[model samples]
Target: MSLQYVQGASLFTHINEVPKQYAYLTQNISTDVIIIGGGVTGSILGYYFSRQNIDCVLLEKSRIAFGSTSITTTLLQYELDSSLRDLEQYTPLENSLKAYKLGLKALDEIDAFINEQGNNCDYEKKDTLLYTSKKEEIAEVEEEYNLRKTHGFSAEFLTASSNPFSFDLKAGLYAMDGGAQLDPYKYTHQLLDVSSQKGLQVFENTEVVKVNYLDHGVEVETTYGYKVKGKIIIVATGYNTQLFTKRNFGVKTTTFNIATKPVTSFGGWPGRVLIRDNSSTYHYFRTTADNRILAGGEDISFVPGIFNEDAALEKYELLEARIKTMFPLIKDIEAEYKYCGAFASTQDNLGFLGKDPKNDKLWYCLGYGANGILFAILGGMMLSKLYLGTFDENLKLFKLDRFDG
Candidate 1:
């Protein structure tokens, strides 16, 4: 039975009327690296490997970026889903800071790649506003602000009086130049397009059905009975790794989002910064290049089965109500598109990005947090180095065995 990963009408403004046709694997092939999944993570791995003259083959079960990548809100924030203070409970403060710094570096790397490729992906550097809706949470927000400032990050504390939004901010941290937004679907296709020219082979509708580990390497058999032999296999398939591993690496949830039609004015939105609250399941929002408000985050526990139309409509209604509440002045903000998809979150809010402890050649890049895209960027870089026999100290923070029983 096929699973529906995404549902409802999702707008594709960033993507043009490009051809959807791609080659299907029908013959056996060999490569230095094999990447499963054609989303942003796999595309990044393909880009880095192909640029370094490594023979990489990427196989996707469906069309490129047709999975979670298409429905992603694309709010790139250096802040983890777990706050820095909260993350300290599971790991060392120094390690948490290292992950935060790595997120910042990933933002820089993404900007550099866009500049180098000159792709029009609606990439924009924006500030992030990590605020609390309740007045009682002001102290916690202040703690986060002070910690970031002490670590040399450019953070400013804001109170209800100083906050620029229409609503009462109570307290917030203005993370300057620490976030970005982009079109993940376009970015993935563009990266694959360029990499294909540099000897990177990509095949859509090629689903890997079985794996045969060899003494020297590994062989992956596709659904079409085509074999792919590679020195290493990177599973960038997001939360769909049940076929390969039995471990529950992350907790799965279904999140909803809605995109509004382009508005005429900002209506006191304040620099159009990316905004997220301090709620257990926070609402995140940002403006598109065309001035549309894209907000999401009414997450519910994941239920395995077909899409529930009634549940989806309820989530969309809640999301729309949230938009109206947040920006009261904006009138007639009709939701042009609404979508819901599966999202995964880890216990420590850090991604799992390294080799499987039981298997030597099987690597994983499961980025399970709000900083997933940033973590994917870091994963591509680190995993490439690991494959080349280089050791990175940061890899220890995301090892699969970090939470061993």
Candidate 2:
């Protein structure tokens, strides 16, 4: 059985056409660093290291960004649904602030890269609206808002009538600045292209069979029967890491995304405001530059054998129904495309980033939950700085040691 999310859409179906770059390790090879899982994190890390003249090689089990990164809705916002006040309970105030700042900085860096490279990825600065249908649920926004203000994050409160939505909500928290959106697949492949030009080698269709941490370097065994060694190894495999480490550090959750036909009346927002309902499984949404509505949420309990075509079809129907209520104009709208994938999430809703305690040179960047794109950019930057031997204060808060359980 194969994962739908990893299977990928046809090259011609996506917004951009990225040439397939595939390589296999048929012979013994060595590099300064070996990156596992060529998602956004590995690709960007390789790009940054290549720029620093480091000999880096990235290995992916399949195509680049063919994992959760491709299925992501790709809303680039620093507005964390995890309450800042809640984060302070588990971590230091300074650490929480650093996490917040780092997410924003990553967004800024990615935007700069897209501009500098002159890549057209439909990246746009938009406001995210946090709204709900229930009047009682409005206070959650206030509670979340107080923390944003306390942390000096720019946010505003909006009543339903204050915004352009045809329907009314109790209240919404709007992050005015530092929030942006993009086509994640295009953005990720663009990084892959740039990385290749910079001497960063990416090997697709090269599934990693095992990892051996040595005193001097890490050795990775591939399905093709060869040992590729590197000074360090970074794992961006997301949920697939469970195959190696059976520890309960990662919880798999399911989220659904449905691309509705373009909603043209869309004056209520510049499409930046993302609404977070105060439900156990919160739903959020944002619009693409072309006016298509991307709404995703309502987490389904994870079960084995739940990602098959049958399951995906059922979830697609659920999302289609939910999107209709959110946007009545598209009553006849059907899902153009649907994706179901697991995002490793921690109890605190923050990512797990650092070298594993068991192996000093084996690092991981996982558990962004619904905010992978934002943290992927941030994780890439931090990993790059760590590779460059720079002390990044922001990376400390999300250290894997936080879960001593």
Candidate 3:
């Protein structure tokens, strides 16, 4: 019945349809930290803090990982599809480089955690391909290639390959060391389990309705009329950020994805790395260990919470049509499920990470373009350090006030 509140179907949902730990909130409680969303970002924050012997509470309005986390194509690459050159323009070169380095570190930490926990989340290293559709773009790719090279980040510039898509390429970059793929939901749930095991409290079906900042702490009121107080409050609610910050911060983009039956024997897929072309409205894909080809990214936009059911169905039909058009090798592909969630994008297409502008104890981590998973991990590390008064020089570059004029 709780699944009815979930808008989309994902592989993670199929695996963990029922909650292994089901405890509803009935009374108010106090904690050192309260994480407002139970997606990848919030879960990671909870896990990290709990490991440090910090008392943390995680609240989800709906079910965990039922939101944008489930909708991800699950590519864990440090090389952003958004041009690294463009990223350097909005933020300092050092900050951009730090973000990239932090992304790789986060992916490595996530893989290590999965292995230690022994959670079968289909984690693997994959090479990410970023090719161009126009010949002129080759020079731009080269510039990025050299830029990354200067920083000691590994990226290979390729003009030709016997890859599946035979589209003419001006140039492309493949980062074999930085890219990865995994089941988004399985990873989120694993973090949840680990956090809980470390004494982190989690309340499902609990939604925060209002937040009041106190002189010494913050008070949060939930839809179920339960109130919680915490020394620091972190909002990781993604598109639902308006609930915490009254001012709207970014554009809400709509992206579609589809998964096919397992292609267990596809020779072209090696550990099922991520593949993407430099189309204006581009598509990126990867294969799951189960052999399903997961493709996504016909990026569009719609007003949040008002997305038309009919329009969403039509969008999915178009995605399925595109998947069938692009990869014809698999004959058993089908669009098993589809839904749309909003991706918060700032003017610079970078995340807004750090403490709230008006409140020092209130923190926010969002607007990560489309690649929120890595940012979530980085955010957890940064926020955890801030709360614990332990500082990492690498994370200092992502402080929230970085964007303030």
Candidate 4:
């Protein structure tokens, strides 16, 4: 079954022009590695593999970064969807700490990649605020704060009085340089552009329909009747993984977002920090380089064929109302763009990264969380090392069989 990706106008696509397109696969090709998706994750994989002197071929059914990547809010945070205190219940504390630390490293990796390419994708470093609206949840927020402090992270606990924003913050944790934001659509193209110059072959409008596992390698058949032979195959498809496995790896949801026109003042939003509440289904807001406010997070359980015009309008209205309620000072704020798309979250809220246990030559790097971009960075680095015969202990936490009890 197919899934609906994006349903409305995305602000990122409106601001950025489509990058150069690649030809579809029309003949049999061979490579060391074949990436199945050409969104941000696949582009990242192509970048990492090509840099390591691997012959990499990336295939996309549609234009690059035109799917869920275009609709992404591009909030890069080290924090996962599940809090550190909560995640420790599923795995060891050390593993949870490693996941958190990996996030920081991923942020640095992205920064380095952007600098190395000299591509301006509106990348910027910013602090993050995880706050709670209800006074009763103050203790839980403090517990999360203490966990971070114990791990040697630079975090501060703030109350309603110390909070910089005008909104009600019963308690909050301010993480220093713990998050960042960028233009995902542009970043994907920039990375592919750099990798293409280094012998990476990217094919757009090329959909892999079937895979035949050979004794020495694998052959992937495209819908266009072409074949791609690779020693290893990497599935970087975001929420679409039914083609690779029958296991239910995670749950899918529809997330809504709204972007406002550029405002002249920051008002009480100090330093324009990335803000997310402590609610179960939290709302997150951040500022764009062009001074527009982007607020997202009215997530609901996924239902087939649920992304229609009526659904988009309803979600957009709710998102617009949320922005007005949180920051009433921004008078005459009009939503210039509104969009919604599918996102996935794992059982433990950690990404699935590593080779399929049943198929060693087949690797999966499905990053299912709010910090998906960060996870993608880690997946690219670790997977590259894995192919070079270097195994990381942390991969145990993200292995495909981790959920098989």
| Highest lDDT model number | 4
Cα RMSD to the true fold for all candidates: 1.6, 2.9, 2.9, 1.5
lDDT of 1 by residue, 84-150 (tens): 7888788888888888899999999989998888856789999999999897899999999999999
Candidate 3 residue-wise lDDT, 1-405, digit = tens: 122323566655674455455465789999999988888878888888898889999988887887777776677777554677776667667666766787788878887887789855778877777777577787887788898889998877887554455345567777776688888777887888888999999887898888888989999998889899999898888767767767666666677666765654554344455778667667777787777777777667755445567766777787778666655555667866565555556544557678876788888877367567888787877778778787667555556666567
Candidate 3 — which pairs collide? 262-291, 262-292, 263-291
Clashes of each: 0, 10, 3, 0
Winner on TM-score (2 vs 4): 4
Model 1, residue pairs in steric clash: none
Question: Which 10 consecutive positions of candidate 3 have the poorest summed lDDT?
Answer: 1-10
The superposed Cα distance between candidate 1 and the true structure at residue 131, in angstroms, equals 0.9
For residues 117-150, could you state the per-residue lDDT of candidate 4 as single tens digits? 7857889998999999898999999999999999
Regarding lDDT, does 1 or 4 come out ahead?
A: 4
Better of 3 and 4 by lDDT: 4
lDDT on C-alpha atoms for all candidate structures: 0.86, 0.70, 0.73, 0.87
TM-score of 1: 0.97
User: Rank by lDDT, descending?
Assistant: 4, 1, 3, 2
lDDT at position 385, candidate 3:
78
Show where candidate 2 strays beyond 4 Å.
1-16, 86-89, 92-94, 262-273, 307-314, 329-332
